[model samples]
Target: MDNRFNFSVPDICDDHADKVQVSNLRLQSFGGNDTFSGPIETINCPDDNSLVKEILNTPGKNRVLVIDAKGVSHASMVGDQIAAKAESNNWNGIVVNGYVRDTEVLKTIPLGIYAIGSIPKKTDKHGLGSIGNDVFVGGILIQSGNWLYIDSNGWVIAKNELKF
Candidate 1:
């Protein structure tokens, strides 16, 4: 799918603040692409990236994967390998409520990655997590199928896809 909405977060907020919910957290960008938007696919996992790997292996159709890592900072939730898969799978972006590793490689991929920070340690592949569920990140309730707009400014969630 082509990128229809290329506007920034502040611009969207200025026009449709009443129709959008902005995430409170100031997530850091680590991907080659800094701006991306798409339908949300939520995952709730804690210190385990088994589900993350599972989803990235499937087709993305330009959708964004929102991983709720329960705010774990001890270990990385995503790294270069997984992110490369996401890019190859046609995923537009990935938003992690936790840390990610391989920052150098992540900066080279075409995917847009937003996370709290970076860590060298990897996550445990316990295959523990739930998919297609509502996840809370930065105090914003991000539900599956919701439209997510992310840029260098921040992220905004809308009930429906918005065109600028």
Candidate 2:
């Protein structure tokens, strides 16, 4: 899957400011692929990553998972194992509102990963979460099926697909 986008967030915003919502959170990129854009798939889970694991297990071509971890600062919502699975499953990227773990291994994955920070603690596996829902992250309302553009500059979302 060719997940690369030629345009940067600033350029996209400049061209489509009225159509895009820029993320306010300062996200750190951890995956190997720095630029990725695709339709959004959202997960709302506060401190549990069970649904995240399940979602990564499925095929993820041309899609990016937007996880709303409810800004949990302690527990890590994603780690190396889940990220590896996402890469293997052909996921373009993952945007986590909270924290991630295994920062070293995360950088090796081919998928794009943007997170608020890193944590050593893993999340609970109680399988408590909802998928395919509207999730608010970084002061923006990211809904399932919305288009997401991400790069070193920042993250942006559009209601419909846009071409550069």
Residue-level lDDT of model 1, residues 15-111, one tens digit each, is 9989999889999999989999999999999989999999999999989999999889999989999999999999999999999999999999989
Off by over 4 Å in 1: 1-5
Report the C-alpha lDDT of model 2 over 33-77, residue by residue, as the tens digit. 889899899999998999999998999977999999988999999
lDDT score, candidate 1: 0.92
User: Which ten residues in a row are the worst by lDDT in model 2?
Assistant: 1-10
Candidate 1 is scored at a TM of 0.97
Give me the overall lDDT of model 2: 0.91
State the C-alpha lDDT per candidate.
0.92, 0.91
Return the clash pairs for model 2, or none: none
TM-score of each: 0.97, 0.96
The alpha-carbon RMSD values of the candidates against the true structure, listed in the order shown, are 1.3, 1.4
Q: Which candidate comes out best when scored by lDDT?
A: 1
